[model samples]
Target: MKIDEIDIRQGTANTPQRSHGNCLPYVGVPFGMNYFSVQTNGAAGAWFFQPDSPRFEGIRLTHQPSPWIGDYNHLLLTAIQWDDATQKPDLAGNYRPTEATFNAHHLALFDDHFNVQTDLIPTAYGAALNYDFQQLELAHHGVAIQLPDEGRFEFTATGLKLAVSDYHGGEDQNLTMFFELSIPNFDAENSGYYDAQNHWHTATNGTGKPLTLLLATTAATVACQLATSYVSAEQATLNLQRLQTSTSATLKNESADAWNDYLGRISVRDHHPAVVQTFYTCLYRLFLFPQRCYELDANQQPVHYDTMAKTVKTGRLYTNNGFWDTSKTVYSLFSILAPELLPKFLRGFLTSYQETGFLPRWLAPDERGMMPGNLVDSVIAEAAQKGLATELMPALLAAMQDSDSKSAISERYGRQGSADYDKFGYIPADNYSESVNWTQDYSYSDYCIGQVAQTLDQPAVAEKYWQLSKRYLNLLDPATGFLRPKTSDGKFKPNFVPDRWGTDYTEGSAWQNSYSAFHDIDGLIAAMGGKDRFDAQLTALCNAKPTYHVGGYEMVIHEMSELAAVDYGQLAISNQPSFHLPYLFDYSGHPEKTQVTVKQLRKLFNASTTGFPGDEDNGSMAGWFIFACLGFYPVCPADAEYALGIPAFDQVTLHLADHDLTLTTANNHEHNNFVQSLCVDGEPFDAVTISHQQLMTSARLETRLGLVPNH
Candidate 1:
């Protein structure tokens, strides 16, 4: 299948209440600054879209990677029929989903209610939108530009310039979006401002109204070029001027060409198109996050607005990613296919450190401090291991250590409970939120920080963090075989409910959260009482009842509900915590068990509207799928070796930065699920683990398949 054949809506039909992919049907270039999607509902907060909805709210200009991370600096464009000159513009109309093209290059929505069609093609900084009419009788129509929150707009003969704020706008005066657009050069007589109450206003400064910019003439087609900036409205105008020459067709073709280039790199040949389609769809989603946020100056130097400082600064930056969510997968994928881009991302994090005096934990324009653990340490350390981003390693390492030494001035920038973790090995159960998972995550981050330290050849520094990483053992309860939360005085919590969700756990119960110490599973096994009991415990975790009691939350969040909805047992693949649970059996000498579960999971995902079992989370889950389907997975990001599993496809080839790496299986089929034998370059390969170096340099991997379990 070709890139254009791959539908962008494969996994995008979702609401916050329930998710197919928990993803937007985003139409933009890969890693674009903004993405455009049709809004099915304007009143809903982050869950504004449903692929099956008959309501067409408008076309949304969104910077939301996940509904959980609410969108910032957004606006919507709706075509209004303007039934009469005295009538107010209506922002919502009915449109059929069957009439729209929801894909990467083109997003076309036709409204039967208005007899108007809205078409859009996106660029990195902005997009080109075209409106087509069915009849000249409605030639007196206009466009309503709606802002969800308070904003200011100035309408022009060409288009409009406006400024809007992010979600956390009340306290954050720094977060201002400067946007400008160029269209049919409509004059003042055709444009007007209307408030949220539908009252036309003469002033453009207040927050009361949405701006209505009318067309120059009721032509058969109307077009516009929109540009957005974080720095100033002037740069937005400059961006519009820069891309003014490109037509909508030119942009649509260019966007498709760009996607074709990226998607074509990894080609899979299989008789089953559904399998192939699923592969490409997963590959497509892997590039949607860590969006480019900074803009370029006249001198071609990178510059960005400091949301924390509320001032303009000179440097490259990225936003809309949380390290806690991404550290386990996304950057590691970059290490393989797109190693060249790692240094630039690292530099962005370094600049983030320089500006804030601490590496960001989570940033959606700025620090939101959402998840537990400052897992950016894992990203830097993993990149350091790959020899990517070497130049920025020094500053990155300094920031890594800062998370260990000092707490942030605000809770959002650095590690939480750092002081408590330093004084006590684990946080007191009653003290912090999600203490057990936070303790485990911090311990792993310590090991990652040590990896960076060792790469810098500071053995003493490396040894220091390595020792701290093992402190997770302090909270391990030997009798119950769970890592329970501890008190400040070194005692376990009084009432321990193993199946209880979210008191000390992060979006998980005890079963899903434990066994996360990939750096040293051997040590963790010993702590839990040797490999036999550990293996049995792992087995019980999978076959045990998938039941939960909402202990902490007033209401069960979606993850808890989704986990119980499926019979995958405790494996909450709908979320990230249980991502590596199937692979954990390998550490206990049960590769066949891992093979069975992984193969079962491959069946759960397909290329369709409701494909993913859970939230994709900026391609982290997609990366996991890609790794699993390829027959190997990065079980530990800080570690360079991949734990071997069964490959889903007969032949998998990777066109990397330098060379091509291929994996081929003999006697391959759906039922022939177990690996019978393996060969690398025509020689039998015995080891279960392959180094990152071998994968990057080698050309082919040959493995034989058998119907029976190897165990």
Candidate 2:
């Protein structure tokens, strides 16, 4: 049957003027089972249409409503019984798609009339089906299903082909299809999902429907045609090639391969599955951004960003925006492995700076300005020290200068090396205290910049910043050893309670922030008067049993305040400040403590859904998990060394660009959480600090396990 004309409307009462964006058309044999539907007006209502099908004899179409908050407001459907003789549709007792049957994006339904309807709607930007679906077919951008009366069908697209031998049987029916779509100038609103308002509109109003249908049909066909056509020669060849390319390209960068393999070895060699998963997952997250922008042209030279722009953009095109939290793990991971991309990554940051003057705090699609810290300096310094060329140094230096001269938030917090910075290394709580965490954040940023200078070999500058890093010491209450907020005149904030919310900090308390001294451990230890006192304070902080009123923000505060909880002891395991604190015991000359604490943290936290103790922080916390599981922790964010923790896996093999690295654990198990002995590349090792260069070269290490030490 020819599809002469089709129209879709958002409202039931009044039909709006026919716009090109509201119409869609499809043509094929009336296979009696094919269907189509769409939700407009931001998922307010779903309109369904189906042909006919004998297989769907007992099925009828039913609509499922979405609840508030979780309510997608998009199209949803079910299947019911069909009366062939009477051509009647029964809705009372209908079968529904299993909960896992449909992704949040689409709904499925079948009726006794042998008809089915599949919901199609966009959820990101602003929810609206703003494309002319019929135009999609004419442009050769969508699939064509050819169904014969004998219950056989063939589906084909730009570069895909498939055929269904017998689709009439239930569950036993075989189907196949090939699919491809050369989607040009295609872009989706925010990860192809809608935000709170249930909108799916795009910024530039690009032709989204074409790309959406093309990709959706491709994916859906894979599920339906899985049994038969999926293993066909054409399909097998495509799949194999894709896999080979992915694996080969990943191992192309020798340094990246080495670092990745080293991380894998630490986890597997230690016999730690949790560590392996978390570590590999963290590594995966790091690759999600600062994407490899240079696509190989016919000659294989770096080409422009592979978008519709058609412009020859150089360097790497990395994108995931986790700058705020990455400094802890993700940043270090990239600096060590993909140092070649550092210049490009820095260039991207400069682009952001050029667009918004100040460097971004947390860059999303736009600059979110979230969190504190002029962390750019730390990244630059860390990258340069690790043999990464800072070609963007001139640009970054200029941005830092501009930031220093400005009297904005940075100046208010005494972040820029201004006159008041020495006297008040941090903005007193009284001076424009917004996010209560600012004081602690100020100290952290100072330490980061100081390390950056040190990495650059500017000792005088490094000394100045290093002293600033110890500014947290000034706020330390000699009575409590907790780093409480202080006034510019060197007085503690009276009536300040360490556990109270908001008053002392954001998301955490003084008890948690007390451990924010990772950047200057020696100085902190000295200030507290030696390893014994330092160890005692740490023990008290970890052992102190405390309950907190987490209330509505339970997810945020509970993990931070409950010190007895393995996750809470080393400062909120959920927060950024405490990420490396568990490994600080190594610096205290008690490597065993570090091992014990690392194992406890991993055990208590890495369960199924609770795989994370706090905000994943765009994989920063995940990075910590990966590190601890692999038997080492960065300890110091800007440093090139990692303190040894207990390893987590039995064997891990990392495939790198140049060579391969392996790790194995002897007598490794959950009960054996302490390291009795260790060796790297067949050599004996006394303590656990691996150099940045060694980690990136791909090697093997083995660890012997033992029981935790008794006090």
Top-TM-score structure, candidate number:
1
Give the C-alpha lDDT of model 1: 0.81
Worst 10 residues of 1 by lDDT: 208-217
Which ten contiguous residues of candidate 2 have the minimum total lDDT? 1-10
Off by over 4 Å in 1: 169-171, 202-216
Give model 1's TM-score versus the native structure. 0.97
Put down candidate 2 lDDT per residue, 238-264, tens digits, no spaces. 432332333222322332333344344
Clashes of 2: 40
Q: Point out where model 2 deviates above 4 Å.
A: 1-283, 290-320, 401-405, 409-423, 434-437, 454-459, 549-570, 605-610, 655-658, 708-711
Each candidate: what lDDT?
0.81, 0.45
* C-alpha lDDT (0 to 100) for residue 294 of candidate 1: 91
